[model samples]
Target chain A: MNAFTRFASLFGAGKDASGRGGSSPECRRVGEVLQMYLDGEFDGDTSWLTDHLDECADCGLDSAEFQQLKDAISRLGQPDTDTRQRLQEFADHLAGGEMDVVDDPV
Target chain B: MEAAQTERDAAFRSYVVPELDVMFRVAMSLTRNKADAEDLVQDALVRAYRAIDRFDGRYPRAWLLTILRNAQINRTRRRRPELLHDPDTEMERLSSTKSGDEFDPEAVVIDPVFDASVRQALDALPKKFRRPVELVDLGGLSYQEAADDMGVPVGTVMSRLHRARKRMRDHLEQTGFGTREID
Candidate 1:
């Protein structure tokens, strides 16, 4: 499916004649929390979600697609070396009492 | 007094020093400017050092992030009142070469075209949607940490972030990336 239709299925917007546009209860549940799972923030037992993805092709594809997107975004930014060093030095100064914390505006 | 000072410094070093990188990342997301982010982190560090004696030494990341967020809020209130509403202007103030300057060298292993596409997709998001992504995806904050930083509920952060990623994913697919089926 194309992006629009695929994501539309995610929101229960459109479904094919087979009623398989992620309309199943398991798929629906996965759809609701798949991002949470991918984000490592899902709170409860995730075994069912994993089992559903393992057994179902469409859910598996969705999981992989979101995972790919998350991975891509996560790799886009980093702390530059100069900033890291500067922050380190600042921390060192504060730890060493070289900076006056009481007079500084936090 | 000297012994107490030495103990406080040791505690500050042990608790706050190791989290400098994380503080910088979260600060960058909050300020969206390299200089402002550095300043904010320093301010947060100062606050953290002052409070290190009272800190219970658990979840130091969360404690430091809370301090950083509070510092950003106070800084905004005291200095840049305009930044409270104008995300576009804030985004513009972000260094043009920020991505290039900060792109992790290890990420060079990934496809350049794909990375560029992802950046474009991210830039296209609305500021509300974009902030959560930057905090969680880019800054490595957990959902709750991002929620705390953004002053929103965890569910709200999750919803915005999930929708944002979906939009980015759609954009990537339209740009002829990540559309193929997995093996």
Candidate 2:
């Protein structure tokens, strides 16, 4: 129907679909489930991938690291409380019709 | 007071107020500066307030972020000829602040140098790939949600994340942080 439909329906793509050049016999199919595998959501055997991780240099090195990176990246920023308070005050003012649009400082 | 204005304010409370923090963080990602991020969020809220009738009463976060992102882009285009700062540079600024005893090295276990190396590799990723990582992994958005926010499909988001995580690993391995594990 569209490019998206085409890309997604390439059914047998499995591991190569990710396009990171991680395809290999042991990790080929493994790549398809790597993200889920890292999250402990994969359906099949754990040691199947775990065994691959033990044997496959790439999977061993990267799978664990990806999890760490996910953690690291998520740790980077916080919701600014000042922004929240200001937005609240702004919302209150707008709600009360106390501020005109022409003089809006925001 | 106009009835429409009162209704809009009520709608803002029901739809917009709860998302202020999320919108602020998403705004920060786009603007890379706190003041600019706050300004962008504020402006986006005003714009959203004006367009509240158009909202479907669903996907509030995505709606606000889409507005904030567009506002930031339009403003950036008007004010500068280039991106405010590359994500890599912005990420480095983030890591710099987390340094010098605040991170509690004994608690985290990853060496600070290696930690910085990991960040460098992540920042080194192409922005298209990096942005998906931010939206899905860092931003805690579902793949479909990120897809909607970025205007791509879920498959594209997954592909981007897969490639991005793969590349980050390759970079870490090259830097010899491959064996290091985080607890």
Candidate 3:
């Protein structure tokens, strides 16, 4: 099986005969707030979540994946040099009262 | 009058000039097109200039970002209605570049293939999901700031942004993105 199938099977292992994955309640709770925890926006106590992440391999991997995704997304924010230069010049003109505001034609 | 005009110009330079790059980045996040983003920033700057005399000069970045958000909303309202969703057009606009030769090598932190996959995953997301990601991740807005811009409550922003990232993560994993080296 490929990596994806393998990773998915790990989650699948939590399922019981009823096909309701028997993952611990802690795991379920962690899953609910993992994004907020990673984003540093979680307001409540985080000690339990941290403890759970340390003990649960599956939850740890999930956290790592989310962190990686965030890092990748952050890299796209850099503005190119030409755009910066154009904006700088425009700001100069606007501040100097050299440019007039014209409505965009509909 | 001349002295007052000079003082207004100085104040504009001091308060608004430093934020031009940030304004463009947020505009790009909202519009997802280079030319359209530039136009949006232009409009916002015009508004800022016109109102500079009345600005209280506190929390300039917040004030400027609010102006930028309003400008984007107005621009959206003025546009001709989109008849139908076109994935190809959406992808093109999301990946739009002003010049091929203007590449910045330092900006790339991961493999091009991985980055392309991430962009594709981002492109495939529904607009409601995609906007939160773009605003928070690509535009570097805090959750509260993004919430304010979208006119939604903080809790709603948190929920949507979390769900959006989860969807993107699922997409990446399905594409074997997790197998790559991550550091």
Candidate 4:
């Protein structure tokens, strides 16, 4: 596996050998686990929440709320509209396109 | 040396120039000023260009960022001793107040109050925490991708991110901006 997949799997987000995961202590939430969830870093194991949501409603609610907080946090102080436009333009330039320069030797 | 120079020039056109803006944004997050950011980005690009032959090309952006990060460290080392001490103090002044406001404090507010709050919080984070947030949130790198770039275990990256977000959330709460309680 490449570095990306290697690292991701190490973080408990990679696919398991079984089609579905069996109950493992690894499923428990720690600070790091909550963090990955908040960042939407999951690999979409439907079984991811099945364990916690089944036993603990509080953790499940926290997970859902944390998702909202993550979304809102991302929106805070987002680059202004003009700056976003400029950033997009810059990204496009990197992706291979020329932007119109108002003043240039040409 | 000859091979390095040739490789550098080619990388400059193929990689560095194309990714200038992305590089600048990352540098801006590090140096927090336009002039310094420009210098940092240029320095990194030049170095990356020179080292292109050694580059594996598996992840050009990560490689460049590693070089840029090293360049930033070297530049920091060369700065006058007094300036390096409490560098955050200077950055704070730059961030809290406007760019230039001689008579009126409101005339040239450096950043909007809300934006300033956010910037201040981000700047306050430790490098371990800050780097993950900057790499993923601002630099648009994924968590796994950042782990590889930062050369850390993925669990470490997640911990840093969690701590960083908690710090940011606390700062926002203290400033009465964000209402989410971090526990």
The reply for model 1, stretches above 4 Å from the true place, is A1-24, A80-86, A100-106, B33-36, B51-63, B70-102, B175-183
Interface alpha-carbon RMSD, every candidate: 5.6, 10.5, 5.1, 13.4
TM-score of each candidate structure, all chains considered together? 0.70, 0.66, 0.71, 0.55
Location of the lowest summed lDDT over 10 successive residues in candidate 2 chain A: A1-10
**What's the residue-level lDDT of A56 in candidate 4?**
43
Docking outcome class, model 2: incorrect
Error of 1 at B180 (Å): 12
Comparing 3 with 4 on TM-score, the higher-scoring candidate is 3
lDDT of 3: 0.72
lDDT of each: 0.74, 0.65, 0.72, 0.55
Off by over 4 Å in 2: A1-31, A36-64, A80-98, A102-106, B86-92, B98-119, B176-183
Clashing pairs in 3: A14-A21, A14-A22, A15-A21
Task: Please give the lDDT score at residue A46 for candidate 2.
Answer: 81
Q: Candidate 4's residue-wise lDDT over B1-183, tens digit each?
A: 556444545554676566665676677667755456667765675566446667766777777788888999999888986654354564455445444322123322322344445656776788889888877665556788789878998888888887777777566556654432222
Q: Give DockQ: model 2.
A: 0.18
Per-prediction TM-score, chain B alone: 0.70, 0.74, 0.76, 0.71
| Most accurate candidate by DockQ | 1
Model 1 agreement with the true structure over B1-183: per-residue lDDT tens digits: 788789899988888898887788778667656677889888898899988888999989989988998998888778756555354553343313345445455555444446556777888899999999998987888998888878999889988998998888777767665453322
TM-score of 3: 0.71
